[model samples]
Target chain A: MEERKAIVEIKNVNKIFGENHVVHDLDLTIYKGEFLTMLGPSGCGKTTILRMIGGFEEPTGGQILVEGERVEDKEPFERNVNTVFQSYALFPHMNIWNNVAYGLKMKKVKKEEISRQVAEMLQLVRLNGFEKRYPSQLSGGQKQRVAIARALINRPKVLLLDEPLGALDLKLRKEMQLELKNLQKKLGITFVYVTHDQEEALTMSDRIAVMNQGYLDQLDTPERVYEKPATKFVADFIGESNIFEATISHMTGDTASIGLEVGNALCLLEKGVSYSLSEMVYACVRPEKVLFSAGEAEGFNIKGVVKEQIYVGNIIKSNIIIANGQMVILSRLDIDEVPKVGEAVNIYWNPDDVVLMKSRGYQIHHVIENASLGGD
Target chain B: MKRSYRARNKTIPLLTTVSPVAIWLILLVAAPLLYVLFLSFLSTDGYNVVFLFTLDNYKNLFNPTYLEIYANSFLIAFFTTAICILVGYPFAYHMARAGKRKKTVMMVMLMVPFWTNSLIRLNGWKTLLGKTGFVNTFLQNLGIIREPVEILYTRGAVLLGMVYILIPYMILPLFASIDKLDHSFLEASNDLGANKVKTFLHVTLPLTFAGIFSGSIMIFIPSLGYFFVSDIMGGGKSQLIGNLIETQFKAGNNWPFGASLSMMLIFLILIMVTVYKKSGGDMEDLGVM
Candidate 1:
């Protein structure tokens, strides 16, 4: 794959608010015309990164480059990036037309050109008739469209959106998600979006940068990030997966044998990555990858009892307790009859379907604590 | 029957909550205003008011001397309000953006002067601006001036006194409105490629305009009627309509004319308020209710 030149580069960015270190030594590259999302939980520094890129915030200890030029000293207005704020910060006093035309007017653009561009941008956001409505008079979705129109009217090289659809209802958010992705594709402008919604990130972004505690856990295409997470945090954060601690028992060419208490299974160590015998590792397998059978099965299979079964529209979700008493979830299409609770079943998975990652030392402890606390 | 039930429910709540304030307003405010209006329509003889109804007092209000005093009062109030805005705006903006602890400290400092009587404070200013007092003495000793310059008892002194007394009124409402500004709008402006000045002009100033209007009214209206500051600081040469009305009631013994002047001030205030209401200023911003 040919790597495109980056439109925005964040290098060793750190932000400290009072005594709290919010963003730490974060580095990222947003390629031109790419829809990149920074996904994380709240307070995980995703919004801070977006703000730094939009020049709303200054990195305490590093440089940010836009179009290969350092913009650390530039004010927000001096930068070529615009932001769609989460609150949809449309000026309360101005109508939609003036709000969208504000950037062009600030640049002293000609009156005819300003109105033409404003109208075009409003139409692009599907807000053509809302030109005369104040922000307070518009619905949340309409306000969001106006904010997007206002930001895009400047024709900035990169648009930074900080959870722009977070205020909408779920159905509207889903619709706007597709609309925004389609808009980005049509405009061919780089989008640096911040969102805590992993599903939204996966649905819209060309690439995802998953963040945890101010560090980039993984950055890759959505399919790759989902199928082969670089770290345990990314695997646990991006989707539903059954993660367990396993000990490496043997190593072979491009593969390794990890021991489970009830049985042993063959798992592939990451290519060009080192693993040692008797080392602890985190093994993740998506619920859909775990196949369930009513009887004993051959090849890396474990005998377990179905503890609970839930029918969710098109899929059946069942919690199975293996022989060693470790619990793992199994999901399968509901085309087959529902598995009876307390019925004995065998769970099987192919070795290649599992992902092996080095332990994120404290994450296991945190998850364990959370699980224990969840019990009444 | 249902409509009548609903009306009864609403009326009971309204009566319970609103009647006390309405009665108090009628007794203390409306009664005095009506008495003044009636007095303004009556004729006065020497120190006594006659029962006969007349418009002579209202006609006398157009006298050139009274007109000049009204003009002086307007000019003084205008400058006081303008200066208050010029000084208070930046101060309020700074306070609004300060850190929590710093904002609290500044607010307390702004309120410290209010603990003492404003009259006493104006007297303190008189001492400072007096010929033998702090400012002139210090200037004389520094050889900047050979003699103590006349600093007190001037038009400038009256304005200084008025602004000093009314600035707190200007600052509080301005602070409330400026501080209430959604900071995200400023960020949005910056993101739209507006520099700080442009952001302030296009975003901050327009949004905080209600504060400016309310604060201006707060200072301007009171400055028009506050006679003590001029009496203490202006040496009588800067007598405003307030002083003229005061003299008419006291030394001049012309109660009808004095009542007429009070009514005129009220009329001006009403006009100003009407203009404010028409200009999109929120009545809630006035903090009157």
Candidate 2:
């Protein structure tokens, strides 16, 4: 694919709050007219990155380029980026019309032109005939629409949204997410969205940047990020995955023979560093990719007993205990083919479905082990 | 039947909670106001007040001397309120926006003057502004004037005392209102491309107007009836409505006219309060509630 021209580029961005390092050396590029989302857990600096882009914060050491020009020192208004904050941040004193017209008024636009643009933007947000109502008088969804109208009225080069649907009910949030994505596509403006909801990121973003502990874990399309996570953290964070502790027995060409505690498994080495003989590593496979049966498969299958079975709507979630005693292996079965609890079963997965994660230091082993055990 | 019984039970606690306040209002507030309305129509014959309905007190209030006193009282009150707001607004705004430690310090400083009796503070001002007081002594030492200047026994001194006594009353309420303002609103204004002065004019001032109006009324109403400040500070030369009413009842021995004048002061306060409420500009919009 040809590289598109970057509408906004962040180079080596770092933000430190007193003693806490919030955003580490981060580099990213946002293409023009692309809907990009920064997805992370709370306190992972997603909003901080959005704030830096909106000129609400200054990078401790780095450069932020907007339209190929550095805007590190520019005030929020001086930049060609407008933000719709999580709180909506609507001016309570002004009615919807004035709230939407505020930016134009600041630019000293003609009164007639401002009214025209404000009315058009309000209509775009589907809030026609409610121009005279104050923000306090509006419902959460209406307030959110007004906020969008206010931000879009300026016709900025980039639109920054910091969890704009966070205050709405679940149904409204889902509806607004679709509306916001459609609006971004219709406007053809570069949208930099920040959200903690992985589902939201997957639903709306043309590309999603997964971050963890102030580091960019992976950045790719939603399908690629979900199907092929770059790290154990991303795999664990984005969706459910059944990870197995194993050691690389031998490496032959593009495949590595892995020895699981219960049995042997094969790992196709597609990315990351090479594995050595007897090197400890993690083999990760999605629950949906794991097949369960009452009898052992022809090859590379482990025998286990179904410990628990839960029917969750369309899917049956089953916890199977493999040969090494209490180590539970999670698998999702179709509701029509769910096995009963305490039934003997065999679990198997294709070699290509396994993802290899290089084991970190001994401390991280304890960390990951504790995390898997659900300990704080 | 059970639903009606449950509804009545729910209302019982609410009624019990309001009963004491309702009784207090009827006896203390409503009874005195009704008595004043009845007295306003009665005629005074020497020391005896007859219940015969007459408009004599209202008619006498229209006389030039009484009207002049009323006008002067208004003018003094207006000037005092204006001065109080000018001095109090910045002080209150500073207190509101200040850091926690600084805000606490400022609040203590504002309340310290009130801790001492108002009469004591007024006497302290008297000593400071007297002809042989510290101010005149310091100026004499500097040779700015050959002798002590007559700063006391003037309308200016009366205004000074009134403003000093009432400034905190204005500041406290204004601070309470302005402090509740969301700091994000100011940030939002700046983000929308407004300069600091423009933001203050379009956003800050209008939002804080409710507090300003309430504080102004609080200062103006009491200043209208506070006679001791003027009596001591103005040396009884510049008598206000308060002094006139006091003289009518005590020195002039005219109880009925004094009652009528007191009633007029209450009427003026009512009018001011009504106008304030009618303005309908709320502080909640400014995030100050």
Candidate 3:
């Protein structure tokens, strides 16, 4: 394995706007040539953290080091990064050619060199013939491409993107996500992308930093963040999961019998982590791990009546109302048999599938909001 | 006659919608201008305006004395526009970026003076800059000067008066334009490796050029005809086109000659307006409303 080099390091960063603490004591180190995404809901300080790195924002308290030099006191232009703003922010008064050429022109580059590099960048963004048109004359996607070209022409060490595809329609957004990912790989440049879209972060990031409530919840590969979230917020923020708030009724070696409102369930305890009797904990289980059966299954501890079933693309999602009237979702492959609503069903999962985590004192409303936002 | 019928149909709607403004313009604006044009080509017979066509009044415009007045008028207009831009751009720029509360207070500060009659305001300047005025008295009491500075009733005084009255016109449009500029553009420019000065030059100035053009047109044209300003401030020492035309009508008793001078001023303004439109200036950018 090659040694991972840290390109930008943020240590104990804090940002406050008026009285609201947008980011609190955030510590993140971005490696060179890796696509890192700060993923969270809006107002979760993801963009603030990215802005602090790009020098657009001054951290209230912290030191940000870019390539081993402190950059908090530097202006954005003096930093070694460029940003592709969400609005595109192409110079409205210049043609596409001049817009792409602006960075080199500002640096007083030679005319021929600027032209060559601008032409190459435009070609790279696949906007080859849009040189003469103003930004007003281009479509949303073309304007987006022009913005990327303009930023990339400077050849900075890192690129900061603040939801660059957020304004595009769904189809264009998907296409651009792939294009931007490929462009980053081809250029071998580090990208610090900020987005509230969890699916986008999952699809595009080499590592995802799940953030909420001004805290860095977890940073890991998308698979790990989705499967083994460090905090309850990361579990809920990622793809849909049913979280069980339960009290530890009994404990054994590497297993615990937790008493949930619905019923008692056997769950896995993290190795070396201790849990006493009646300690409150959150148990997260992916929907697909919970099975819905017409008849009582073996080792079935949770039972509920079928509330509703939805067909989502290739998967069938069933909501099972437990004995406590709490709806626990069960996602499965569409096997042509959805238990009728109001019918009884047995819901169960393997004990190891439940990942027990500490409760962060979040209420049920926050989980529901994140689930609905994920649906969007 | 189908085309004629179509035209009539269009006219019926236009008549209902636009006729009031059209009639107002033609009757009040065009009629007087046409009368002036008629008088400019006519002869005055012993205080009686005659309907005889003559170019004598217009040819008199080429006289060296009148030409010197035109040159002086140009110089005053140029200086007034230049000074207003130099002073107003920074104020407008700051106001545009200021917080809403501060911006509101500053906006009130800028507009409160103009709410009063401009003539009265210029008269206030007269008292302020007079020989025994507050400024002179302050300086004399401070012992900074043994004699009062001759600031009042000079060309500089009239120029100052013009700028004071017209700076709001400059600042309003420039403020609107600068405020309309997306703040993200500055961030983008800085992100693209341009410093503040470069960003301002390449982005801010180019985007707000329409405001400058509209403001210049507003200040330059009015400074030429603000006859009362020069009268009160310049002490009638140097002749301006406004004073010349005023003398022709009041003391010289040559309405035809005065009409000719007004027509020439109108011609100069027309050229200016055409240039403004060509450069993409709009009435909305002028912030007149």
RMSD of 2: 5.0
DockQ, computed on Cα atoms, for candidate 3 = 0.78
Per-residue CA lDDT of model 1 for A216-295, tens digit only, reads 98999999999999888899898889887777888878777777767666777787787777777888999988876776
Model 1 chain A worst lDDT window (10 residues): A360-369
The candidate with the higher TM-score, 1 or 3, is 1
Candidate number of the best lDDT: 3
Candidate 1 runs further than 4 Å off: A1-3, A250-257, A260-266, A295-307, A321-327, A360-376, B1-31, B49-51
Give, for candidate 2 chain B, the lowest lDDT window spanning 10 residues.
Answer: B280-289
DockQ of each: 0.73, 0.57, 0.78
Candidate ordering by TM-score (highest first): 1, 3, 2
In the range B41-147, model 3's lDDT, one tens digit per residue, is 99998687888999999899998878788899999999999999999999999999999999999999999998999888888887888999989999999999999
DockQ of 2: 0.57
Worst 10 residues of 1 chain B by lDDT: B280-289
Restricting to chain A, the TM-score for each candidate equals 0.92, 0.91, 0.93
Q: Show how many residue pairs clash in every candidate, following the order shown.
A: 0, 0, 0
lDDT of 3 at A25: 92
